[model samples]
Target: MAGREGPRPGGRSARVQASVHGAVQALMTRMERAEITIPMIAVEAGVTPSTIYRRWGDIQELLADVAVERLKPDMQPVDTGNGGKDLLAWAEQYAEEMSSKPGREMIRDVLAAQDGGGAYQCCNFTKQQIDVIAARAAGRGEAFPEADAVMDRVVSPIMYRILFGEAPDTAHVARLVSGAMGLVSKAPASV
Candidate 1:
């Protein structure tokens, strides 16, 4: 009967919920940088290992969820009434975000895990992000094939730079964006 709180199960409260969520994010950040076994994370977060497991189900699930939470892709599609400008904006923003230290590390972690089909599993969240772009492009009468081609080009190089630590300067981003635009322009109207 001692230490029992009214109404809340497991002695958890709304404020405690926020803290646990924050702890999860912090743990994921650490994990992305290096090995982060659950026990270490639990100790760092001041929570029991059971609490982490109960909240996230498993390590992979926790990582995937955290990665999904971090990737806030701009949902706006290239439709500034001038397709080229919109596409360029997308490229610049995407490049800037992906090149950041934490962003690159998170992506690298997810990609490395992809070997055991974990990549595809974790990618469901990312695909939703792509769908947003697709929707936005479609809304502006942009062809799906063109949009897809453009995005593929724009994202691929950024990923490459992130993984390899290669330079992705403004010139590089512009070039890639331009290349993608060229492809999109040449793509067949349908399919």
Candidate 2:
């Protein structure tokens, strides 16, 4: 086959990444993280085990990559002309997703892999999401909320509850969003 001759350059590499990512996602839907092996992923992705090992080294790294890619917030920023409202909307969406079954599974898997040192970087996904929101607020001439503040006030609460066996409901998320907005409003201009 085309891929068997050797690495087929950019197009084939992209295809392999997509296939492996898709396989990981599909397996996550049907199997626990501990049960997912590199061999199984390679089989599902229609690639050799060596290919997976060569690219990712192990299942933890692969899982981290998959989680980061799958968990990225949509790039389009919410532009409601009010930075607080836009931030609230974004936080609410994030809270809702993190509370869902699949979302919880993804978080669990990624966190479990963090001890290996590769998965902690997946948290950068949240940083990127915040950057997108901050840029949108700036574009609207509104005060941009500090990313660290948003993380502590908004994301941290939801994640804490998730890890503790309680998923925040919409009302709770709304409250968290409001609290985050309050912090942003009171934050010094230098923030």
**How does model 1 score by TM-score?**
0.62
lDDT, candidate 1, residue 84?
57
For model 1, residues 1-191, the per-residue Cα lDDT tens digits are 11323325545644444455567677665655357776776776678888766665556555554555566454554555545566666667667777787676657555644233345543444445556656666676665434456547766667677678775888888888677766545543453
Residue 45, candidate 2: alpha-carbon lDDT:
98
Candidate 2 to truth, TM: 0.77
Question: Which tens-of-lDDT digit does each residue in 63-150 have in candidate 2?
Answer: 8667767776666657677777777777778877888887886676577563433345556778677777788777756676688888
lDDT of 2 at 96: 78
Scanning candidate 2 in windows of ten residues, the lowest lDDT window is 1-10
Which candidate ranks first by TM-score, i.e. highest?
Answer: 2
Which residue pairs does candidate 2 place in steric collision? none
**lDDT of model 2 at residue 55?**
74
Model 2's lDDT to the true fold? 0.76
Cα error, residue 39 of model 1, in Å, equals: 3.4
Which regions of candidate 1 deviate over 4 angstroms? Answer: 1-20, 26-37, 43-47, 54-61, 74-79, 114-118, 121-145, 184-191
